[model samples]
Target chain A: MTSLLYKDWSIIKKTRALYFSVLYFSLIMPSFQNMDFFGKSFLANSYYIFIIYLLFSYLTAYDYKYNSDNFIPAFPVTKKQIVAARYVFVALTFAACLVLQSVVRIVILVLKGQDINIMNIMDYGQAAILILVFSLYFGIVLPLYYKLGYQKLRLLMIGAAVISGTVSSVLSEVGLDMNRPLVMLFAVIISAVIYYFSFTISVNIYKNGN
Target chain B: MNKVLEVIGLEKHYDNFTLDKVSFSIEPGYIMGYIGPNGAGKTTTINAILDIIKPDKGKIMLFGKELNGNACEIKQRIGFIIGENAFYEFMNAKEMAGIISRFYKRWDWGLFNKYMREFELDPGKKIESYSRGMKVKFALACALSHHAELFILDEPTSGLDPVFRSELMEIFQQIISDGEKTILFSTHITSDLDNIADYITFIYQGRIVFSRDKDSIMTEFALVKGRKDQRDMVLGSGKIKGMLESDVGFSALTDDRNWFFRNAPGSLVIERATLEDIMVHFVRGNKKYDKLAI
Candidate 1:
């Protein structure tokens, strides 16, 4: 397991361009905007960062298909270790993104003479909730991407997301808070359930991936 | 006397392909040549052995243990080199080796570097910059560097030149010289196996047609060529599996080589069958015991 982690870390470092780009957009770009716009921009910035992280996570699944990490499976490593290492890698990536986001938020507040309430109890609570939701959402998506493959799932995911977003926008004009915090909470629960199943499916698929 | 790898009744079902009760065993100190034509279930069988694809039914025992429980432990002693250039294109050979080294507990960096030098592989260049032969050589270096007792290779010689192929074979011979390691090499390159394999297993249409000692298979199966008039005489013998008849005469596969040598005595060519000829004869479905040229 440690070996797997070391391998992934080295790969991630080698491909640091992707990581740096994400950091630049999420953490560096927001500071260039005015103070009054910081709060509003924060929401879009966070969501954009989430989307990019999700895409990177989805793309990492191709490591299996392309045989990038093919030799690892043939080593003295169990399937469980392989999956756990992957999960840990995702967790670390997200953690790095979160830290970058936090640093940017702090810098914006300082430059704006804003009340230092950003990291307050409510703010921390919201951040914690968002992390939980995003983690659960990704836990459901990453393994499926690995099993179904990147090409098929990438098209399906984009198509489905587009259709669903359009429908949700039209419904919101008719008065819908489906994107509200409460709804997000409920969705998180549902994602957790799906995540459990997806995890099991990936385990079975990988065990049989020869 | 230890059976390093044992596969019994292994089957994998696909929409277009079904691997039937395929079975073979590799004991320490011998090289098993897994020969077959394209899409002949050679890779599928190897995949099942490595648990890459779960078998529909059957048992795979490695190191005297059930495969499921001892996968990691069993895998530790095993090395694999697939036909595909499976590494990331962005990674140089040194970086790739470092990544690979972390996976095995008994990785020997010194030995890996030695093999890389021997194979003329540059460890600092990205795989994308490598020629096909270089990629193969690099992969082989990484695979053999670890303390592997058994090596499973799929078409390791496919794109390599004859000289390098011979060099790689020599390496395998040296690895097994101590009589404690084993190799299971699957390839369509018959000459590679002909020069090295102790046991030969032929797979056809997802099933094992035959697996025997190399010398025994060579002695048992004979390819006969003759003219058209001898067709009846050959068919009368009823020893042919199947035959292909052309304008020049016929070519066939037969188990009774001696019978053909003694009975069909006119203008017949009884040659020592090469591994490639045997593979082609079986795969072509021309099983006639006697091959008569018309």
Candidate 2:
């Protein structure tokens, strides 16, 4: 299981564009709050989610591009295990970025003698909400990736990420109070259900070659 | 397990191509050559065993365990190499080998390094920069390092040069010479298997044409060359599987070699059929391959 995630991580690091994207994102991630589109923190948070979706897409693209997708299944891992590992990797990538961005933000603020809220409960809640919402988008689209492949689904993944990210952000701004501690908890349960359902579909599509 | 692999009543249906009840098995410690023409379901069968594609109606057992329920466990004991550059092209031999090492429970880095040294491969060169033969050596290195009991290779020697192909055959021999490893080597290069393969499983149009030991195949099949006058009798012979003909003569494959040599006219030429001839005639299809128009 660790091997499969390592494979993805290795591919991500080897691809030049993706490696640079990781660097570029981490540098800009600390400032996602400074840029806003419609609602306060809309572009900031939604763009982060959108970029995460793209990073995941690019990783999948690289695998398909390199023909490693063909050989990955031949490894000593089951399809279900591969699916589970991917889901975990997605969560890990998001978590790692959040940690990095927070550290950088804290350092920048300290260097400027500004207030530090890096470990604020509200900030963690917002991060959790973003992950739940991101999982909701991934839950619907990842299965399609297994079916149609990375090339055909690349545009759809991007377009869907933008639209879904926008709609969720808009919802949080308007009525849902998605930032509420209670709603964030609710989102977690719902996101888990979606993740489970999507994983089952992805595994079936992959294992049966549908 | 007595059998390293057993595929029973295997059937996969596509709109245009269907694997119809494909069945074959390999006992432990034997090199089984899986020979078939392009689009003959060789890859499909290999994919099924690897669990890359599920079979519609059949069971695949590897190392005495059902593949459906125990694929992860069964797969650890199996190592495989498909086409060249199956590894990521951007990664060097060492990088690829390092990642592959994590997949197997018993990966031996020392053994892998030994193979790299013997193959004369530079560990730092990316796969894209390596020649086809070198890429194969890299893949083989990774496959062998895992201490796998069964090795499933698909067209491992197809794109390689003749010298490297022969060298690869020697490596394959050493792998199984210990009587502890098994190989299911799929390829159209029948000559490579002529010297190394203990058994041959021929698939044509998604069906098993013949699956038998090389010695048995050599003893049971014969190539008969005869005058036009004797063509009818040879064609009518129940033993004939496939035949090729010319205006003045005819050549046919017969299952009963002794009977063919004894009963054939003194003027006829009869000899043991080589593996290449056997595959060519079988792939050509029995009567469809005949040149009676001549």
Candidate 3:
């Protein structure tokens, strides 16, 4: 499993996109003084974007680059081990982003002479939860890629994200409670459902004949 | 002898292509050559055998057991080298080895190092920096390191130079020399099979054309050259599978080389067919067969 994680890390590190995306979000966006938090919270929340788009792109690209299906299927390790390693890879990247985000947050606060309080940590924690929640999107959507192939699934996911976002906007316009506690609770429920479904789908995907 | 790998009636269907009931077996002590042209279902057959894709029909037996239920156990003894180099370009050979070693129960550090040394592969160099030959070498080293009972190689010689190709063949020969190991090597290069394969299986259009002993295949077909009229007469005899007609004359493949030599010594020139010749004949024949049906 350690080997698998190392393999995943090594693969993702090679891609310039991963580094640039993570660095831009985790370290760059958070430091911008004039950044409108309400207007660009999604962008400012680099941790969330890193987990969703970057990490998803990384894992998806990893399969194509390394022929993960060809190599991993041949190994003695079980499908469970392979799926576990994938999660670990995503988790490790999230952890790295957290550290980078914290350092950037501290540096930005020091430069501005602002009090870096527990509230800041809490904000970071919220971002971390959001990242985890978004990873649920990856877990649920990625397994479909095995069946549909990457190009098709990619377009499908893009369409799904757009449609879902549009629906969410319409719901919010109708006064759906998207306040902090409600959003957090919804995210938790969605994450749990996604996790359970992802695990099941991953197994089915592994067993699927290409 | 225990069968190390057995593929029976494995079938996969797509709108554009279908792998038609392909079957073959590798025993514990011999090498099987899986030979075909591009788009001939070599990789698909292998994918099915490995259960990377589920076959619509049939079964794959590995290590004397069914592959699905016994996948982990079977995989433990199987080392596969895919046709393509799919390693992380940034990771050096050492890191790649380090990562792969964790998954195998019988991973051998000393053997891995020995293979690296033998192949002159510098494990410290990143895969992106390595030449194609070096990448193949590194992949080979990884395939051989663990205590594998079976080695499945997909187009292992595609980019290799002649010298390295020979060296790789020697390693494969050495691997199976112990008599406990088996190999199923897929390649478009027939000469490699001529030198290494104990048995040969030819595939065309996602179907097995033939699977037989290398010796038998070699002995079966004779490349016969002759006048167009003479070849026509021979063709009329109904044993010819490969026939090429030209302005000057005709050359064809005959099942009985000795008979052609004996019966048409002055009419046709009989030549021994090498594996390459056999491959050319089959590939051409299959194409001609398709065209005629259309």
Candidate 4:
């Protein structure tokens, strides 16, 4: 599993220039003070989710470009292990993006001579929403990719991106309050169930697929 | 004899092709040449053995253990070079090797470096820049770095220069020289297997034509050339497995060389069939006898 993670990292390392540009854009977007609060929140949250999507896309593209799907199975790893590594990679990317965003937020607040609240409710709610959105999108995308290869699922991926974007925009537009701890807990539980089933389906699809 | 790999009654079906009841085995300390024409299920059989593709009905055993549920464990003892390029093209050979090394328990860095130097591959050069031959060499280097007991190579000699192809064959010979390693080499270039392969397994239209000792196969089949009139005699004798008739003369394949020698006219010329001759005749000729009568 660690090797699979390392393989993903190696692929990312090859596109260092492009990744750096994306990271620079992500870091500087939070510092733009001219935007309204809603706009600012939307930009930051979208970037957070987009980072995970971009990383997954890059890894999957690399796999397709190099025909890794044909060779990876020859390795001494089970289909379950491969699927588990992908899920773990998603989790790690989310964690890393959260840490980076939090650090950037702190540095921006400190430079502006503002107080930082370590236990901010809004911050927690936004993070939970981001996780839920990613979970929902990947829950649908990953298993489809395992069943039908990337080439066959290209149009479906675009459709999924559009649907997920509209869903996120609608949730923001309605301002549905997720401030309650119970609601956030329920969202997490639902997302967890979706992810677990997605992982199971992906394993079976990959095991039976060529 | 200690069998390192055994595939029994393997069957897979697609809309246009089906690997029907394919079966073969390879003993330790020998090379088995898997020769077949295009779309003959060579890659399918290898994929089934490697578990890259699932077979509907078959049993594959490696090292005396079933490979169905124990693929991960059994794969550790096997090395594979399946496609034209098996590593990430964006990464260099060294980085790819480093990543692959972590997957196997018996990966040898020293051996990998040795192959890297021997193959003249620069560790810093990206794989996309490498030529087709270089890519194959890099894959071969990685496949050999681990202390794997079995090697399954698909078209490893294709696209390589004759010098390197023979050199790679020599390396294969050296790999099994210790009487521990085994190889199942699949290639359309049958000449590469002429000097190295111990057993020959031929597949055509998703069926195994013959699987026997290479020497016996070579001796058992003969390419007979004579006038077109002899075609009826050859076909009537039931010794002609495959035949082609042209304007001037006709050529046919037969397993019973003694029958042809005794029955063929003095004007006919009989010669031993090379692997290519056998494959071409079997694949291109009529399927009157789908199975090898021998």
Candidate 5:
């Protein structure tokens, strides 16, 4: 599992796009200070929407880099372990992105003669939202990756959109908005639960073949 | 343990094609040539052996253990090259090797360096910049450096020039020279197999036409040519597996070469069948006898 994670890191780290995209987003993020969509605190942070899209691109590209997952089984790892390594890779990269972007943002703030409170630089609420998006998007959509080939991106995209849309409508109907403290806690719990179930789903799909 | 790799009654079904009860095995220290026409389940079989795809109903044992039972351990002992480029194109060979080394328990960096030096591959150069032959050489180096007990190479020499391909065949020979390793290489390039393969398993349209040792298969099959008028005599001989009726003459494949030698009419030419001749007749000859089970 550790070696597989190293492979994933090596794959993206060597590519110029990973650095370029992260740096690009870091510089452009503060401009969206007033960027509150889906009714304010529903998204305490929206920058990772770009990250999610880039993750998709990377997933598609890396799967292609591995010859559509043909060469993955050549290694000394199980299909389940391979999927777990990917999840770990995702988590590690997200943490790295968070730290790098935060550090860059801090340097920019200090250069502009701003105060040095970490809390002031980043919203704790924003970090939690980032976690939610990470868990939610990956939990729901990534199993389809293991279940289907990358060639079915169009089908995956449509399926993802429909699922997310339906969830948003249902949440809005129940008045369980992210702005409410209890509702935010509930959303986090739900995402964590979905994340656990998603792992098993991905494993089964991978083991069973596409 | 006599066999390094054994596939028993392997079956995988697809919407369009199915691998039907495929069975073959490789001894501990021999190179097995897997020859087949396009879309004839060569890659599918390789995938099943490596556990890349689950067989609907079959068993694959590698290194004497069921592959599903001890996959990680078995995979650690096997190295494979399934495509033209099997590494990250953007990364240099050094970084790629670093990542690959971590995946195996017994990675030999010194041996890897030796191969890199011997193959004249610049370790710092990115794979995308390397030529196709260079890429294959790099892949071979990686496969060799791991000290793998088995090598599963699919069409490893398909696109190479004669020089590089010949060099690779020598490397393959050297790999099993110690008599501890085995190799199963699949290719449509039958000429390459004739020079080095110890055993040949020929498949046509998802069925095994024949699988036998190199010399035995070469001896068992013969290409016989004669005047077109002798076609009736050859047809009546009940020995022709497949025949091409051309304008000048008719060339037929027969397992009973000795029978033809004793019973040919005037002016019959008989020659030992090469692997290419065998495959060509199997596919391009009459459909009725193309799947002759020998």
Candidate 6:
């Protein structure tokens, strides 16, 4: 499993320049417009989610392009371990994106001569929402990729993105008070459950799949 | 004989194809040549053995242990090359080897470097720049570096040149020369096995035609060619397994060379069957005698 992580990181390392460029645009582009902190925060968070999604796509694309899906099984690793490594990868990427986004937020505030309270509760709430959205998106898509290879699941990925976007947008419009700590905690709990089940389903799909 | 690998009643089903209850075993210290034409479940069988594809119904025993739930442990003792689909294209050979080496507990870095130098593979070059032959060589380096007891290679010689192919055949000979390591080499190029393979397991359309000692198969099967008018005489001998007809003459495969010599027309020419002759006849020719047909 650690080897799989190292292999994936090696793949990501090759495309570091592209990923950094995406991160730059995702962070800086939202700050150019005249908007309140909440509005700017929302745009920056959305872009962060976009960047993570792009990274996920690149990871899966590399697997397909290099045919690692067929070869990795030959290694001394079980399908369950392979699937678990992917879940761990996503979790790590999510944590890294959050940290990067926080850094960018602080930089933006400092440039604007605004006060920086990096531990804003509302920011945590928003991050939790992003986590829920991403967890659900990956939760559905990873299993599909295992059951039907990347080529066959391309349309399904697009459909999943659309559905995730629509559902998250609707939840936001409903004016749910994500600022509440209890709400954030509930979201975290739900995402964790969803992620756990997703891992189980992905393992089964990969084990039984061709 | 100690069986290094044994597969029984392996089955896999797709919408268009199904790998029936195929069975075979390879003894230690020998090369088992797995021969089949294109789309003949050769890859499927190999996949099942590696547990890359889940079998519907089967039992795979590798090195005297069941290869089901203990895949990670069993896989460590086995090395495999699945065609040209085994490397990360963007990483250099050295980096790829590093990642693969971490998965095996007994990875031998010295052996890996030896193969790298021997195969003329540059460790710094990325795999995307490699030609097909280079990629295969890289895979071989990784497989052999782990000190695996059993090697399952799927068309390891497909894209290689003649010189390298023969060199690889020699390498296989050297691997099993220790009388401990074994190989299950799957290929459509029958000539690759003619000189080295100790056992031959032939599959056609998802079924095993035969699995036996290579020398036994060679001696038991014979190719007979005769004039078109003498087809009846050859067919009446009750020795024809498969037959093919052409403009000038008809050729047939028979299990018994003595039967062909005794009952065949005077114009008929009987010769020993090579692995290629047996595979081509069984796959392309019409089956006239199901009694002898595997």
Candidate of highest TM-score: 4
Worst 10 residues of 3 chain B by lDDT: B285-294
TM-score of chain B of each: 0.93, 0.95, 0.94, 0.96, 0.96, 0.96
Compared to the true structure, candidate 5 yields what TM-score?
Answer: 0.88
Tens digits of per-residue lDDT for model 4, A1-210:
898988887777777733773566555766652466554355555555566667777788878987888889889988789998998887788777767767777877788888877554135566667668878888888898888877787677666665565566556556666565566677678888989999999999888876
Sorted into a CAPRI-style docking class, model 6 comes out as medium
lDDT of each: 0.72, 0.81, 0.72, 0.82, 0.79, 0.82
Off by over 4 Å in 3: A13-47, A78-84, A91-136, A143-190, B261-266, B286-294
For residues B133-243, write the lDDT of model 1, one tens digit per residue.
788778878888898988898888898899889988998899899998999999999999886899999998898988888998788778788889876776667776557
Instruction: Write candidate 3's Cα lDDT for A27-76 as tens digits.
Output: 55664524654333434443344344556666676677666766676677
Q: Residue A203 in candidate 2 has what lDDT?
A: 88
True contacts kept of each: 0.68, 0.75, 0.77, 0.87, 0.75, 0.87
Off by over 4 Å in 2: A29-32, A35-37, A117-129, A175-183, B285-294
Task: Arrange candidates by TM-score, descending.
Answer: 4, 2, 6, 5, 1, 3
Model 4 misplaced stretches (Cα beyond 4 Å):
A21-25, A31-34, A37-40, A155-159, A172-186, B287-294
Per-residue alpha-carbon lDDT of candidate 5 for residues A8-103, written as tens digits (9 for 90 to 100): 767667666677777766766655544555544232234454455565567667767558378877788899899888776666666777676568
Candidate 1 falls in which docking quality class?
medium
Better of 1 and 2 by lDDT: 2
lDDT of 4 by residue, B45-151 (tens): 99989978889998999999999999988999998998887588777778889899999999999999898899899988988799888888788888888899999
Q: What pairs collide in candidate 5? A: none
B196 Cα displacement, candidate 3 (Å): 3.3
Q: Find the 10 residues in a row with the least total lDDT in model 1 chain B.
A: B285-294
- The global Cα lDDT (0 to 1) of model 6 is 0.82
Question: Which order, best to worst by DockQ?
Answer: 4, 6, 2, 5, 3, 1
Note the residue pairs that clash in candidate 2. none
Tell me the deviation in Å of residue A186 in model 3.
Answer: 9.1
How many residue pairs clash in all the candidates, one count each? 17, 0, 3, 0, 0, 0
User: How many clashing residue pairs are found in candidate 5?
Assistant: 0
lDDT of 6 by residue, A1-210 (tens): 998888788878887844784557555655542465543344444554556566667788888887787888889889899999988987888777766666667777788788876354136666667779988888887888787887787766665665565555555546455666576678879999999999999998888787
| Tens-digit lDDT track of model 2 for B1-294 | 489899999999999999999888999999999998889989989988888778899999998889998888888888898855658888888888878988999999999999999999999988889888888888888889978999999999988889989999999989999998999999988998888899999998899988889989988887888888887787766677788777888778877889876776788788889888887766563656344221
